[model samples]
Target: MLVFGHCFTKGNYTIDAALKGLCTEEEEELERTMMAYWANFARTGSPNGAGLTEWPRYGAEEEYMGLGVKRQMANG
Candidate 1:
């Protein structure tokens, strides 16, 4: 299974730290993108911001951001 969440891992002396060095450049980029989204959401009510992929609001199309090897907007 293609599991995620490694990039979002936190804490100083935890499994996340131990596996921190194992992240590839792509994974690191993913982390930056996700962090940007979170920070933007915290600063504003929406996650959409400049220089990032446009995240559509949840609607009938069921669109969402797909965080993975390559981050992009996806729709169900």
Candidate 2:
């Protein structure tokens, strides 16, 4: 249930932890989605991609992606 530092950890940790049942299915899904976003952003300038949730640019709305068991867009 600890999401802190997950993005900085190795990808194998996510897969291994999921395979070992150390993480919930929801957590795994969120990690995978995050990984995809990161990879896409590294390849391109933006994180937006097909099949993934839209990551809106930061603006006056102060919107941001709320990463958790249930990932969603949240307004600050």
Candidate 3:
């Protein structure tokens, strides 16, 4: 199922709340986009299979994509 969560981020980035001083228009956009993609995946079990950019599945790699337009890790 397609889903988005604070997950390891905990209550910092939830569906109804975001980190204090961090919740802004930019965050709203991200949440909206996540919701859209999440719904699509939930319904189809595939995200952007065609006519869309391929979103890679997560791996054990320490680095992952982030807000800075580059891959970064939690400690970065």
User: TM-score: which candidate is best?
Assistant: 1
Check candidate 3 and list the clashing pairs.
Answer: none
- Candidate 3 segments exceeding 4 Å error: 1-22, 49-53, 57-76
Q: What overall lDDT, based on C-alpha atoms, would model 3 receive against the true structure? A: 0.47
Model 3, 1-76: lDDT tens per residue?
1133332244545543444344555455555556555777898885444433455555665444353212234422
Cα RMSD (angstroms) for every candidate in the order listed = 3.4, 4.7, 8.8
Residue lDDT tens for model 1, 39-72: 9999998998999888888999898888777777
TM-score of each: 0.71, 0.70, 0.40
| Whole-model lDDT per candidate | 0.76, 0.74, 0.47
Ranking by TM-score: 1, 2, 3
lDDT of 2 by residue, 1-76 (tens): 4463354455657544544535666776777888888989999978989888889899999999987777689898
Residue 43 miss distance in model 2 (angstroms) = 0.7
Ten-residue region with minimum lDDT total, candidate 1: 1-10
Residue 19 alpha-carbon offset, candidate 1, angstroms: 1.8
